[model samples]
Target: MRIKTKGFKKRTSVDEALKILLSHTPLPSIEEIGISRGLNRVLACDILANIDVPPFDRAAMDGYAVRAEDTFGASQTNPIYLKVAGEVKIGEAKEIEVKPNEAIKIATGAPLPKGANAVLMYEYTRELDEEIEVLKPVTPGKNVSFKGEDVKKGEILLKKGRILKPHDIGLLASFGIEKIKVYRRAKVGIISTGDELVNLGEKLSEGKIYESNSYMLASLVKTSNSIPERKGIVKDNKEEIKKAIKEALSNDVIIITGGTSVGKRDLVPEIIAEIGKILVHGISLRPGEPTGFGVIEDKIIFMLPGNPVACFVAFETLIRPMLQKMQGLSLMAYSHYLVAKGILKRKIPSEIGRRDFVRVKFDGKYVEPIRVSGAGILSTLVRADGFVIVPENLEGFEEGEEVEVRLFHNYFPAP
Candidate 1:
């Protein structure tokens, strides 16, 4: 899987390229992390409950614990009365027994006393000195949460490869799971190449642009729950680029922006072919046609475009999914990305045999496309709300046509 000296003439489809890249990428390693810090981390193995949730049969309502038979035939017109026993407080293990014709005042979540089979809510009864009146009858086990009712001991609570949420953390804590095994986050090394590029805080000279793709890619990696190692800037020289690539190979994934296009300084593909294998040199996609991918020493390398907007699109569509795959997530889970439908404000022209991602501003009712010829226009991405994809087989979208828009924000505009 190496690129020839003549370069790639036929571009690989987006789906086929992703299949090849993922087939080579392996699941990340596992580590034992404290449950307190497990948010967004993928579980490495199935998590079984070691103990029953709630731990015991407890009260589900604030009421009197009594035998269901005692309240039989009791009603508002003609009520039954019982002797009041001691009160039961929550978290108390003190033993208290209920005798026939007797009731114990129990609070919500308080354990039911021995000889008690049901709870009569306080609303259904009233106290008269040393006696309690039951206006309603309760069946056995009514308002009582039996032991192991919420979660039985040894029950599988969470499955492997599941992304942990706040509720999952609480459940683990409930079972006294202080630490858990989770897949280690993929460490991605971001390298920005080209002598024409300058880092932030440096004044831009003629024919130089401030480096933004590295920072953009870093944020993208962070949002995907991965570690981003910004390798700073590198010149287009083969030795310098090769040295940086070698250094970045230590990470689990390598991402190089710039030097991926067909030009004299575009040496990323050539250098990668020399050190390792270039699995994909180009993809059939608009705004990111120069996007490439390869492997160096078993680590996957993504060759992204230099333009900030193109870089952002390529990362979100291609690299982000790859990162998720490496962390043990299934392709089905990838569909959870925020997507909404909106009416197109205008027609979007596209060429056949190439997929296009057009940035659009969705103002609840319609999605207006941001028209820009240069892929380097970064402001359009900032001002736009989301993007709409046009398939390679279609020409474009018609005005007022409903289309699916992948949102940058998690929420859709209110109607």
Candidate 2:
């Protein structure tokens, strides 16, 4: 199952690889979905508030509603008494008006009566027979949530291409919006290439290994808000690989794991070059140095390394951004992650022309590296809190150097 050959000679820099990936045309389909199903979906159009958020002037607190001028100059020693007009029940919209020396009972969030302009908390007034005595002075419009205070009618609340979150869903619901238009999730096809690959739960032969890269890639695709379809495994044969790739082109993006490096069984790169143009045959990055990317027709094909760690790195560094672009999300938005500054506990070495992603766990102040000698070690990624990207220009970082650590999904070492 092993092949011996010279390694890839020409390697594309990280920036160049990203540029090539961005060249592919993304899927341009839109679908309307309910707000409940809009989480993580990119908005296809701007969301303008059809009506004001509150829609009407509402009471901001629970108390007696009255004209603010009525309570002016009133103190506990000489309190002004107002007759109880009526109670305005929430959602009932009772037409209660507070004339001079009159008050109406109002609750929080209840629509304010047409003639009332202020609210006096129940604790601030005492019941005197049938009237409540207001012991405090108030200003006009006090405690009144005016109409259009929160949101004006026809105001643009959310812009297009914004990714929906839970808060966004609630905001849409506030306007009684039940459905919205969003960019359709891009469907990606994941194909595992190699005759030595075996499906999970199957008995592993002497040379065959379990096929886990497909699942990993599928998870990555899901994390990127894209749909993933595992197209199963294909052998090293050129025709079979080509056939699989041809079928996968139906998807928005195709990912081929294994058989990307320069080896006798590495037919993915060759087949990709034959069917489409290979944009990047190799990358100047550790763990994922053997990665490849290409375009066929209007679809993007990513050739990732066979090692699970390498495949994960390649997907995060390249494929994730492409998927975001297809979904109308900004590639520059890294809000999902938490970034922190920590001092390196020890020095990390790297080649001059190659970028390295060193996974390290940080205890709020110091970053501890997760040692790994081979890219096939998947535990390194699991144990590490995040990774520090060493640029190609710098050789490495010295101990005690302050480095920006991009945490993995907001995870940080506990104090």
Candidate 3:
């Protein structure tokens, strides 16, 4: 095929592009999974308690089950005696009725026997071989965990769209819930394209470099709690790029890095337009202007710039939210990053119409910007701690201005 080169007639703003992308995001399907594997998974439906937690009245402490009236006026000076009915260990189901003036030894978590209205702690009672002396009195229902006290039957335990945590799973287990309905993990396909790219572990030619975009994109997908399928590297040829995209349609989202700009080898946009609809082709964002997205057969397709830094920026600004939406998570949630406010140590320049993601390091006191002219400098991302976003409405931030920094990594260096 003949090569063609073109220029962007118009570019969309970062906000508008993101709006278009999210409007086309499809809802994730639901699947039944065991509670053991539900951590971090989104619930598809509200979890209603089918049965009350602690199913029956049980002992909350190691004590003797008795009637509250029988322990009245019992103290160290004058003790009341009761005949020992039987012993109830934890998880035992023996039926031992506490008759008048009768006490039963009950272990913690053991079911309270019939006719027992309270429990007297062992510390306040003296066991005298078949007869126990009550030194203190307990009110009705004391030291007893009532049925449905923790969770009531037919009550909403957890709401829909909630991200399951370790404690949430434990709560479900307490209710004897072995399996739950959760949204299925979105599968993302990542494809890197370029004739000058070579895979790792292979000999590199003079003009070729090892491909790294797919690996980085795959890791970003994993961070969003989605499955990533690396489609391998494809040359700049139109047929190869088209074929790879066609195969990646099996995934819920397809991310194609490189070959998205308005150049002779940038054939991805043209091909996607031929096969489907291009929602947005160019964005007004620094380091990621070539970022775009489209749809084919209901599967969302993302066109990311080949430059490593540009790829990273586009993923954070655009694709991350899309993945969160796909997995039934809130788009505004940034659980992986820690947000902090710091004063700028120096000024950063930017155009009025474009948004800029300036990488910066925080020294507990001031935020220092890491200067880089090009988007291909991957080392800048590693050297910097986090990034500061300058919105399109502002020209830039001046020195000593307080700005919010989103720390991608856990370690925040102190001054």
Off by over 4 Å in 3: 1-6, 333-335, 411-415
Q: Which candidate has the highest lDDT of all?
A: 3
Q: Candidate 2 overall Cα lDDT vs. reference?
A: 0.84
lDDT for model 1 comes to 0.86
- Highest-TM-score candidate: 3
Superposed model 2: Cα runs more than 4 Å off: 1-7, 333-335, 409-415
Per-residue lDDT, model 2, residue 64, is 87
Residues 238-332 of candidate 2: C-alpha lDDT, one tens digit per residue: 89999999999889889999889887778887778777987777899887999988889968899999999889878878887787777777775
lDDT of 2 at 323: 78
Model 3, CA-based lDDT: 0.88
Better of 2 and 3 by lDDT: 3
Please state every model's RMSD to the true fold in angstroms: 3.0, 3.2, 3.1
TM-score per candidate: 0.93, 0.93, 0.94
Give model 2's TM-score versus the native structure. Answer: 0.93
Give the range where candidate 1 is weakest over 10 consecutive residues by summed lDDT. Answer: 406-415
lDDT by residue (tens digit), candidate 3, 1-415: 2213445668899889989999999877889999999998999999999998779999999989999899999999999999999989998998789999999999999999999988889999998988999999999999999999998899999999898889999999888899999889989999999989899999998999999999998988887888899999999998988899999999999999998888876899889988998898889988899889999998999999999999998988898888878777788634457888999999988889899989999987799999735799999999888888888999899999999888867732210
